[model samples]
Target: MSLPTSTASPTPTRSTPRPATPSHRSGYRTGLRWLLQTHGFMFLWALGMLVVLVAAATIIVSNVTTPAGSIVQHARQGLTWFPFSIAIVGITTYTNIHIGAGLTRRSLGWAALTAAVVMAVAYAALFTLALQLERAVYGWTGWAHGVDGAGGLFTSSGQVGLVVLDVGLLFLAGQLSGVLVGIVYYRAGGWWGTLALPLTAGPILLATPALSTAALGDLGLAPRVVLVLLVLGAMSLAAHRLILGVQVRKLAT
Candidate 1:
């Protein structure tokens, strides 16, 4: 007998793609490596600056006139250091994502300049903020002192919080500058290896605050005012160094 004609029903199938496995996600190797290199540069460079400062302080305390060009020399050092630092920090991090992220020296020249501009902007912002904070504190405590001489930039602690913050900012800037210089040293010529970054940053960087202290003191400024200026100047120097650093690293293919 002929098989009874039976209609078969078809089952529907869902075709969604499978989710990515955990192994597919990118790891933190790049960030960790950059952090290691950057932070190492900062610590060693800062310690080196401190040692240099102590030596200079010792000489000055013995009645020797601190060198005439001491502070200016340090400030110049910042030009190379600041830009280079900004460049390396950015380039290094970007490189992990794109191995060939370097630009021509010409382009880097512009980038370096940009870094300097950024430093000024940052300083202005921070200084303004610090001043505002100082005003608020003064308003609440009713404590304000000192006169701002010509070019009030080198003036003092009408506000204690500002005084302390100013010092901290300078110290941090110096440390960051050192780190950038070191990184550039290594990038410019990897052969010097570990020592490259440190030595590159060793010059006037360590003596930044001391240089400022002597310079401001020579102007017959008060200790508190001089302290603030010294710290601020050091920070300015660090900023310049970082800008130069950014330029150097950005150019280093």
Candidate 2:
């Protein structure tokens, strides 16, 4: 008898692929570092320029007539605008590069925010110190250091906390508004951005009511602080909304 032929098919083998090892790309950390470096350099450079300009102005004014008061407060107020402008430019120009290099939009947004807060705090501290230095110089020269003329939270006497808070809030608002404008321009292009300017800049404009008590005529401390905080919150929310799910645009060569 012929042996029965085996008809059982060979067992099919399935090759299992191994799971990928977790990647520690350090993308978030890298983005944060970049933000800090960029922000730090811009701030220092702008501050240096401001110091030179203020010193020149003071010298020129003094030659004509002894300026009655220090310009520290004025200088700090003006300096608030720079951080915002710098942040806007940085965000608009660098988003594509950062994303392409493996950074998430969410990470970039948070990093930008953290850098803004740090920048604000640093500026506030430096500005306060500069004012103190001005006061000392005024003392040495027998001149009054009365340029705290804007007469709001920042201009208050012996209130370093309030001054820091005011400056911090202003810078925060400025930074956020800058981001909003940049994002709007990037998403909506030129004409739409121009039309949207008032909305994007609303927070900055609103803060003015609280920032310059002299111009608004003593709106009271609580009310002014509340206004500033509200504007800051609004701007912050707008920034987040603008930043989420942001699409990176292609740059022209």
Candidate 3:
């Protein structure tokens, strides 16, 4: 019995390996989903509703006062500020959480870029549609929808293509500028961030329809498009670089 026990051996147990970290591609997908789900969709719905409310109010005001200009046009400032603020939050707030969730900085950068593009297109389309609706309402009410110098990109709201192009560029610039601002603030502190406004927030100002019309209108659409693309490209590159080396700070409660 002792000899037989000595010949026997216990079976070895196998240890389970820990799961690998998510890939950058997967991280990008996750980041994009988080951005859209947390901010983009809600903002789009709110913006759409706001546009409708503004259009209705404008109609009422036009009918009562016989106003000469488009009230909806003034909503452009809100549209620009909304995306810009959200983009700043996306960089400052979400970046820490994103990295903590095991996502790569490169993924977050791409996600922000893609989200900006999507939001820009969506805002442009909604603004264009609002203009068309306002135009129809004005026609029905016999109100003169005059174009002011601020809306110099188009002679009339009937210019749907130009409206979309101008709005899209403006929104994209705002978003990119916001990212730049957020990164500067996060990396360089409040003072540097405020000081960097001319560099960080200047792109949106430059991309405004009125400014574009005044400065580059004579250069035609092609040159304006190239200029915008160049600005966007540079902003994107700067943001990407900043994100890559950004140190995640502990968020205050």
Query: Highest lDDT: which candidate?
Result: 3
lDDT of 1 by residue, 1-253 (tens): 1111220121112232442431111112222233334444553563356446534653673356423221211222333344345445653454323233332222222232233333433433434443455345445645452323222223453444543343334434443444345445435546663455454344334434433433445543355445545644543454335333443334535
Better of 1 and 3 by lDDT: 3
lDDT of 2 by residue, 153-216 (tens): 6654356777777777777778778888887887778899889989986777778657776766
In candidate 2, which residue pairs clash? none
By TM-score rank, best first, the candidates go: 3, 2, 1
Which window of ten consecutive residues has the lowest lDDT sum in model 3?
1-10
Give each model's clash number. 25, 0, 0
Let me know the TM-score candidate 1 reaches against the reference structure. 0.37
Give the TM-score of each candidate: 0.37, 0.82, 0.83
| lDDT tens digits, residue span 1-253, model 3 | 0212311331121232333665665666677777766566657665777777786888688568877877777767778888788888878878888899988887777777777777778777777777788778778888887666545466677777778877888888888888899988998889999999999998777766433566654767777777787888888788778887888886678
| Candidate 2: stretches off by over 4 Å | 1-25, 215-219
lDDT of 3 at 94: 83
Off by over 4 Å in 1: 1-88, 94-102, 144-153, 157-193, 203-207, 214-253
Please state the error at residue 6 of candidate 2 in Å.
61
Candidate 3 has a TM-score of 0.83
